[model samples]
Target: MKVIMYHYVRRYNPSLPHFRFLDVENFKKQLDYFAENFGFVSQSEWATWVTTGQMPHQPDKIILTFDDAMSCHYDYVYPELLKRNLWGIFYACSQPYLTGKMLDVHRTHVLCGAFEGRTLVAASEEVVSPDMIPNREREEFTSQTYRNQENYSGVSRFKRMLNYFVDPALKTHILDKIFEHLDYQVDSKGFYVSQENLIEMNNNGMIIGSHSVTHTLLSTLSLDQQRYELEESFRFIESITAQRDRTYCHPYGGTRSYNKDTLSILEQLNTDYAFSVNYRDIDDTDFVSSRQTLPRYDCNLFPHGLAS
Candidate 1:
């Protein structure tokens, strides 16, 4: 079986043309392809594989997962899944609801989308403080932080610099500087689904899971900080969802985005499954694969996932 991960799934807003998002129509086409090739796995069947590491002798099985719990998942993806009687795990962050502020991870995405990469790069050059310089080599940092991005070359580089080179304490500060330099502000409203929306989805059989409190890279945080990120986010999910499943999708979903401490924290939290963007099929022979940090392919890697 294969698990596919998705983020924003709404049609590209004419307002944010540079913002990379999967169109609804293309998503529908992907669904058709998956239904024809790999039938969507049932909730119980997937649970069995997750719990007992035993999958029935079925090669035509797939699991759909959505990360970030963007409003687009509720507004666009949910109805489409409902139409096909398909289900997906939607991972959510709690900071927006708790603080009414956008997360830095998402704020950077919006800012990176709003302006040209050259423009953002120039702005970053001006705003990058001496204190913010990374301790390691920049090229190595970019290579690891952003291995294979779908963004245009320039934007991808700028994202890598911002994502890795800056200290976490100064990440938002530098982002703010770039936005100020561009004379633009990232809008915080309605970017994510509401608690009521989560409840409705849960009541209707959709599964909900935690992403993190602020979507920071878990590998960068201390043990207690990691625990807080998972615990706080899961608490919010439990408050809203009727589902009893304990699952989490890593913030960046990359292998290096988490650590041994992260797995330990998940085990402590009694989380049954966690997802990472390892881009591989789930092999029943590899019990360790699904046990923790389960692999997931980005939707863009599959046919009909990207616009022509």
Candidate 2:
């Protein structure tokens, strides 16, 4: 079986074109390909198959999953999926829904788009402390990560650096300053769905899963911190839907983003499965091992040939 992961899926806003995923028309084309060539599996069926040794009757079965639970999913992706009688698992960060604040990642995306012309150093100077920049470690990390990209710009590299290395509190402070400087307000209507929307989605056959509370890099946190993130996020989801699938998707989901302790915590919490961003197909052997680190293909990797 194959699992496809998506982030944003709405039409491009001119002010924030970077937040756009595949547009509505191309997204429809991708769905058309999946529907024509593969059998769709509901979240329950996929979870059962993961927990048990059983395989679905159809070998061509595939599951769709959306990460970050953007409002775009409710506005654009949900109606289209319903039209085709398909369901998807949405992994949502609980803090935004609970606190009615925008995710820091979304704020970063908006800031990057708004100040695309400015280099990261230049942009940082306007909002962040002078001490934050010119760190030897930060420069080294950014250089190593983007060394292969021939056309990578300073702004892009610095944005990536800020995401992984900067302290979360400092990052938020810097972003808030930039937002105010630009006269931009965080999405006040909420970037993620409300409790009502989650319940409605659950009732309509879609599955809701925890994507952590603050969406912090799990590997950067200690075991107790990881436990709090996992447990609290799961509790929040269960409180809303009154159902527990005990499923999770790693925040950031890179190789170093989660560790063995994270899996241990999931096992203790009775989590059925956990997904990683690693791109590959799932084999039957994966059921016996690697359920917690199961690989999923990012939808952007194959724009034209998802089913091929």
Candidate 3:
């Protein structure tokens, strides 16, 4: 069995090309491939089969998962999954959904949509065509811009204050505008799946899983803090799902983000399982492969377009 994770999926609409997510067509092709190629199983079934040796007589099974609860999932992925009668899990970070805070980042994301490919410094350059320059050159330009400024002594003194009240990169075409929007949203808003959204997602067979309340890296925090994060996430997710099942996925499950101590804490919490972003190695014995450290392949990484 293999588990696959996916993030953004939507049409690459140019107007909001920042929101130009994975085109809906490519997303559909992946789904079709999943349906035709292997048995799609829920996380629960996969867990059970791993431990109890019970499966529905299939040669292979794959589990699908999505992270971040991006609005794009609601607009694009959900309908497609429903149309095909597929089930999956959605690991949501609770903060953005509760407040329109996503608008904070998203708005910045939009304003600077054109700067997506450029570095933070290049995006700050005054030139109209910043993207034409390479990242290293852009860094040098921005460094020079900062170096040439005279009133920046006071600016540096109150840097945090300025970051909070105003976006410094507000003049770089689309980039600055995007940051402005995000700043406005984060300071004054919140976005969460409405109660209705949660109920509907569950009813449609999507299991709700925790991605932490604040999305902090668990391994980086103190032991107590890590435990608190794990427990709080478990309770909040269980409340949202109205299920006794407790499962969690580490944020940035890549090499540096999750480590042995983090796994130890999760084991103590007795979480059913936790997923990591690490990929491509699976063996039958891998079933017992540390409940707190399961490897998952991202759909975006593979050629067959299957997520796991």
Candidate 4:
């Protein structure tokens, strides 16, 4: 069984742009292909299959999931999913749902406009100007207190800097301005599905899972911190829906994002399943944990691959 995940799904409207956004036309192709060739399931369905040892008859079993609950997903992807009667796992950070806040790191990434430098150029045909340049200097200015640029590149160092400061409200404000600039129509910072929306998803057969409270790097945090992040997220979700499923997807589920210790902590927290990002599945091991750390294929990678 090979499960795939995605983030954003929207056409590149010149009016509003974002870093993780994927073009809507390509997004349609991915769904059409999967509907024709594979059996689609939700992440929670896979958990039931794994725990109960039920084997799906289909030769190719695929699960669909999205991370961060970006506004684009609500605006574009949700309607598409509903139109097709397809379900998905939307892993959301609880802090925002409860308090309307997000981790500073994400705020920095959005407000800092990291994409404006390289990604914006790649996304658009327009030539970037000095005045239109992204705010790397402001990112550096805010992050220098904790980041050591001599040893790390700006983006890498700023992430580490954000981990040191833990305040959901502060991060929320920074992201507010960023999203506003990205789309002047709405000030949709910390744009996550509301508690009511999560309940609707649950009632509609979609799964609401955890993406941590603050989207912190699990590998960098101590075991206690890691466990806290996972446990709190699980508890918060339960508080919202009164559901028992405690699934977690590492904040940045890339290959090097989380390690063995992180997996061990997930096990310790009694997380039913965990997810990570990759094109292939991790080796399944008993002591290690479930290979449920599923591979998420970024939709932007379509028409070629991740590099494209």
Prediction RMSDs, each to the true structure:
1.6, 3.5, 9.9, 8.3
In the range 1-308, model 4's lDDT, one tens digit per residue, is: 55566765655544333343556767777788777766576545566565764545563666777887776667777778888888777888877766676555545545333344333222221322234333344454354432212222344433433343323234344344444545523344636666777787777667788898878766556777777877788888887765556678878676455777777777777777777766553333421445436555554444421211
Best of the candidates, lDDT: 1
lDDT (C-alpha) at residue 292 in model 4: 38
Q: Where does model 1 exceed 4 Å of error?
A: none
lDDT of each: 0.82, 0.74, 0.58, 0.59
Ranking by lDDT: 1, 2, 4, 3
TM-score of each: 0.95, 0.87, 0.69, 0.69
Taking all chains together, the TM-score of candidate 2 against the true structure is 0.87
Q: Judged by lDDT relative to the true structure, which candidate is superior, 2 or 4?
A: 2
Q: Model 3's lDDT to the true fold?
A: 0.58
lDDT of 4 at 179: 48
TM-score quality measure for candidate 4: 0.69
Backbone clash tally (model 1): 1
